[model samples]
Target chain A: MNVPLDPKTLVAEMSPVSTSEHIAAMKKALLKNIQRSAYVYRVDCGGCNGCEIEIFSSITPVFDAERFGIKVVASPRHADILLFTGAVTRAMRMPGLRAYEAAPDPKIVVSYGACGCTGGIFHDLYCVWGGTDNIVPVDVYIPGCPPTPAATIHGFAVALGLLEQKLKAETHVEAAGETAALPHPDIPYALRVRLEREARRMAGYRQGRDIAEEFMALLEGRAHTPGSFTLLECMMEAIAEERDPRRAEIIGHLAEVVQQAIRGEAPRGETP
Target chain B: MLKLLKEIFRTGEATVKYPFAPMPVCKDFRGKPEHKAEDCIACAACTVACPANAIGMETDTAAGSRTWSIDYGRCVFCGRCEESCPTSAIRLSDDFELAVGSKADLTRKAVFTLADCACCGKPFAPAKEVDYVARLLSQSARSAEEADRLRLTASTCPACKRAQDVHHIADMGIARQMTQELETTP
Candidate 1:
């Protein structure tokens, strides 16, 4: 059954709340001068609760965020830092704004998780506002699906001015005479394709690519070396030297593919 | 009190000194996706692989360029981009301290020039991709003429290639095609 939707409740794009110069100066002073304990209040604007779990874990004995005087309070009124988690769904927008208002002035607003930062996988959803910045001005953004406990502590340290942020905006423009180099220029393209296809069929994409790269490196290395042994003999020797059974098995299969290519036969396991 | 103190001393401190000390992360930790733009061909494979659309590419035919951008704020750190990158240009590094004061600081971009098509003279693909494919094809080509032909084929756009194929087929006279079709049918 489809429920009737209300057009009046829908929001397309809400501009981020503008902070006045006075308020901005006050916030800068608060960040610079404040040496007191920072009490964090978490506002769930409609999330999967993964960020909450990571937050809770950060406060646990192993992490013990209390060591730095960072405490998670029950009320937003007492919160020095407001940590907003989620994509800010339409239904939770009012509550999220209420929490933002409830926090005292000079409060540091933190957008937590990928969802809170940029709505994550749900950015295009009709109900989501995209990010916390869409509703209230955010002072910091902690991005991850659910940031690890260590990462959470690092984010807090960055917020409290204890640590500096590592990431910086970067842009690269194409330089003159710049070109991407081709991989394995010495190897025949057809043989490389056959080997890669065989390896990919055996393993998944990531591991398959890795295996193919290793096999190709070995192939190229053999070509450069002056040797009495044939290519097949070198491959057999390498296979015998391999310690891992699984990797050895994959190398053995790749060798078979190379042999088939040498014989001008079609790749195995495919309909003619 | 003495027994409690002794047990506490035996257990040692439970809290970890994180901020002051360098925290150790396990191997294969998926943290931030680092993009090596120099090695990236602007193929848009990572953009297509991104589940959250954190990595995106914009092609401008008028400008004759393709721009690749990645928003760290929206990234889920799933390593799908790393998996999809053919050149190993993008990989997840251990630097997880991604908190930024500004939203603009969370983004990275790379602009690459596009190669214009050989036939239509319109920007179609990244220049690096066309070059890389031509090089790869030439490596397997039997003769110098074949290699040059493959290079020409690689440089042409798909639309132009299709048009060439149609034109080639049309050059075979309609009467000849009809006779061949009739003979096959009989």
Candidate 2:
């Protein structure tokens, strides 16, 4: 019983199941007015289980996903919504497809977590298909490393039509004569670099940049009115106002560095 | 039964009023990466720093434009892009609701014009980046001549800069030294 198999047919065979017009219309109706409880079946293709933990947490007492009539079911047979929670791996492709097929028609497919949406950090891996949409048509995409319980709830809300999706695709084109303005035109570039380097060395990049910006603002204020107040006096005032001891110490250190720069002396803590 | 009812009442409702009311997020909550395109120099720092390859850039030399794009669906909310940004063009905002109905809706893009090389007519880097660097160097420059030199250096392409370096080295009579070494070799 040898049947001749066409190469083109084999290639086309791997494509995702196409929805019929009846099923599409039914899905539209389901999305429009889904009054009953939506049973969700989580399909873990090849995840690290971080998304699973978040999903369970969303169902917990504090988050209470059941309050919205959303329940996690054991089998796809009982599911009205399929929650795909991993980057679709080569090994799990058949299983993922099986779960999708097991679920009833007009079922909503949700691409959950960063992995499920677009494979997250593992997008370029050899075995991965990059996203759930590669294997199944996704009705909703909930992106996060592993979304928080609240974020998960919001995603469910969007999926169920209870809430609207906030993010819209945006494209910004450079207009004629549009230019990025200099951050601090008044401050010397060298001094700004030194100050930013010192601040970043003390605090982390995020906090360091913030502290550097604040210190530069203070320096600029003093520079604007040299006769009004001394730079040291202004620094002392800033230090006094700061509640955090560590931050105050960093600010003091930055002030000393500024003072050394002003006096034409090499930076204090570095080897000459 | 009364004690149970009293206990339930005392506990209160544990569910959050999300979707209906605004949810309060903690300080430094890494949710959605917001890009202030106006401040961005199109340096591709975020694209390089992004762990998920969510941030990407495409340069069309023919079009004389560079397009910067981010697929939120692929972003892991790691904050690496925010950290690596020199001008604070990109930062993680508190907005977390990123669910989308369409795949295309999950992407955001920005287009920037490319600057032509001072030596060659070909487009090289982003205009904003070259302008920003030129301005930064000029700010630190000691004299007007030095500022002009810095501006020229910033605007020139790498190939032309290399060519200039080679020409300068050639003018230094390095070939004479090479011949001298060859004659002196035992």
Best by lDDT: 2
Across residues A1-272, which tens digit of lDDT does each residue of candidate 1 receive? Answer: 24455579743545567778888889889889888899999999999999999999999999999988999999999999999999999899889989988998888899999999999999999989999999999988999999888889988888887788888898999887777777788878778878887888888666788899999999999889886878789889989999988889999999988888778788766643
TM-score for chain B considered on its own, for each of the candidates: 0.90, 0.92
Which numbered prediction scores highest in DockQ against the true structure? 2
Cα lDDT for residue A229, candidate 2: 83
Q: Which stretches of candidate 1 lie over 4 Å from their true place?
A: A1-13, A200-203, A236-243, B1-7, B174-186
DockQ of 2: 0.74
Q: Is the docking of candidate 2 incorrect, acceptable, medium or high quality?
A: medium
TM-score of 1: 0.90
Each candidate's lDDT (Cα)? Answer: 0.89, 0.90
Native interface contact recovery, all models: 0.81, 0.82
Q: In DockQ, how does model 1 score against the reference complex?
A: 0.72
Question: Measured by TM-score, how close is model 2 to the native structure?
Answer: 0.92
Candidate 2 segments exceeding 4 Å error: A1-13, A225-227, A268-272, B1-4, B174-186
- For residues A60-136, what per-residue lDDT tens digits would candidate 2 score against the true structure? 98788998889999999999999998898888988999999999998999999999998888898987887898888
* Tens-digit lDDT string for candidate 1 (B1-186): 999999999999988888788888886788899898878889899999999999999999889989999999999999999888878899999887888888999999999999989999998999988888888788888899999999999999999999999988787677688889999995
